[model samples]
Target: MRRLLLVSCSVAGLLALLPASGAVAVELPMRKAGLWEMKVLSGGSVPEMTMQQCTDATTDKDMSTAMAPMAKEICSKQDIQKTATGYVTDSVCGISGITVKSRAEITGDFNSAYTVKTSSQSEGGLAGAARDSNSTIEAKWVGACKADQKPGDIIMPGGMKMNVKDMEKMKALIPKK
Candidate 1:
């Protein structure tokens, strides 16, 4: 369960870190409207996960709201610099008792497919364990959504379907000390 949570949180963090469209300092290019699938390959405490999401104009505009409750505990500052081929992101996020500093570079056209390379470190938390992880996400247009899937619907690797906002409701079900 812990591993699953970690995987879910990591995915959330990645999504939250993605540059949103608007007057923000760094805005990622908008993707094509369609069903997009992301494949996560992690080599740290986080397990691999695959998630498919339906993206339309509305959902694309409201993407910043898709994250776990734990993400609220993180205070982040990001700077994006455009490169010749892509954009580079430097971000510092404080999570739990650790401050994660990461640098990521994104390349390729945002409409069909793109790649992100990230490296991060932590100074405190769980015996000050410093974990380094990198992931590659390949997203492509998969046509229209199915009858059961709607915009903002996310399907997890194990066939779990959820709306990212529902995470808070699920967390409320857990007993706290």
Candidate 2:
């Protein structure tokens, strides 16, 4: 009975947050068009990561539009609000039986540099236990993309290069549990 009550409350909380969650994409300020280098500092579950991308306003918008469907499929709540200091985002995303609740604070001018700090809690899964983690992504604008690079091109570690538009194709390669 206690477990049922907790489950019921969780569902209710999620539903209440999305009274009008339709497919609306939140409007965000665009970063200056250029090459960007992003460093991710995450202490748990995975090691730190670094990547570079060539992006323009159109590329950013297209990436957001393309990811909407996947996000809606897994996330029940995703809210972004402008705060006095910066922007705050809260999301509840679940896959299989594991649910992850995360909150992120974003700051800095999108033109030159930006930072995103996130803290997340997970339960009802994660190897049959719960886990918590925090991460920060710091990004800075570089001069420009390489001559051979195009908009939406991302250079990952080990010199792996991929375009944002190709993400959907790679998604199919992931095994579903």
Candidate 3:
């Protein structure tokens, strides 16, 4: 009687705690097609570039070409985490075992927006084994068209330039068929 009730109450209390322990939720930001700014922050040989510089250096056509190769390599890495919503990849790029993790949103737009966040370690071994050496990089970008845009329209805080070719290239790399 009393002992049976005590046992049942303990079991119910344990079951109630199970949901709280196993619950997990992740939220991602929303992005739409339009003009956007980019910023690249990196360590090592890769130069830190602004959104304007990337937009200027890449034309819609050129961007399409470069991004194809870049995305293929990035998506195929072993450390990549793929989910129904998006993907994340972590890798070691240099001989020094510098780790770089890039996270890109899986979206419907041909030229999907992305933000890559990278972290690195200086010591020549696995990330955990390494001593006190860590570095980080963040890259952000957006893509879209303007009606007033001509064949070679450039928009920016400065006089930076971007072409349809670059936009096209970026669009092709987005995760849509």
Candidate 4:
């Protein structure tokens, strides 16, 4: 159950990090090729987690492709606008039984470092309790991937490792439509 929660939390956060081209007017820049370390901090209920991902242009492009259709299917509204400081996004998405309405501010370019501050309200899930959450995710390019790591490889908390390209095999772990 802990691993499932970890995957759920990771996916939710990752959806916000990726560039949502299908719904947004402005195209967010892609991350530079390297290993990126991401820290997720949410106050209150959710726990803080950190993970690292190895990626290149092809991997990033594949992620965008995979996410575009899923977002279009599950998200009812997704709006993004650029500001002098960075980007702001508002989105409403329903995944499985939970409905999430969120707003986020993204700052800094993807080449070096980026931060995403997100506030969201979620309701109508198994817990049956409505909850409000505020989270900040900071990601930075640390350098090249380890010799053993390849593109799409992610090192999760507690040294759990997975590859994004292999997620399809774990579809059962993902929420259903």
* Candidate whose lDDT is highest: 4
Model 2, 76-161: lDDT tens digits are 88887777877777888776677778777778888999887777777785366776666677889988888999999989889999
The local distance difference test score of each candidate is 0.63, 0.69, 0.35, 0.77
Q: Rank the candidates by lDDT, best first.
A: 4, 2, 1, 3
Error (Å) of candidate 2 at residue 101 is: 0.6
- Residue pairs with colliding backbones in model 1 are none
Tally clashing residue pairs in candidate 3: 11
lDDT of predicted model 4: 0.77
Model 1 weakest 10-residue run by lDDT: 66-75
- Candidate 2 matches the true fold with a TM-score of 0.79
**Residue ranges of candidate 3 with Cα displaced over 4 Å:** 1-31, 41-66, 70-79, 83-86, 92-115, 121-144, 147-157, 164-177
How high is each candidate's TM-score?
0.75, 0.79, 0.33, 0.86
lDDT of 4 at 59: 91
Q: Which is the better candidate, 3 or 4, if ranked by TM-score? A: 4
Q: Which regions of candidate 1 deviate over 4 angstroms?
A: 1-17, 20-24, 44-47, 65-73, 165-177
Provide the lDDT at 45 for model 1.
59
Q: Report the candidate with higher TM-score, 1 versus 4.
A: 4
Candidate that would win on TM-score: 4
For model 1, what is the alpha-carbon lDDT of residue 146?
76
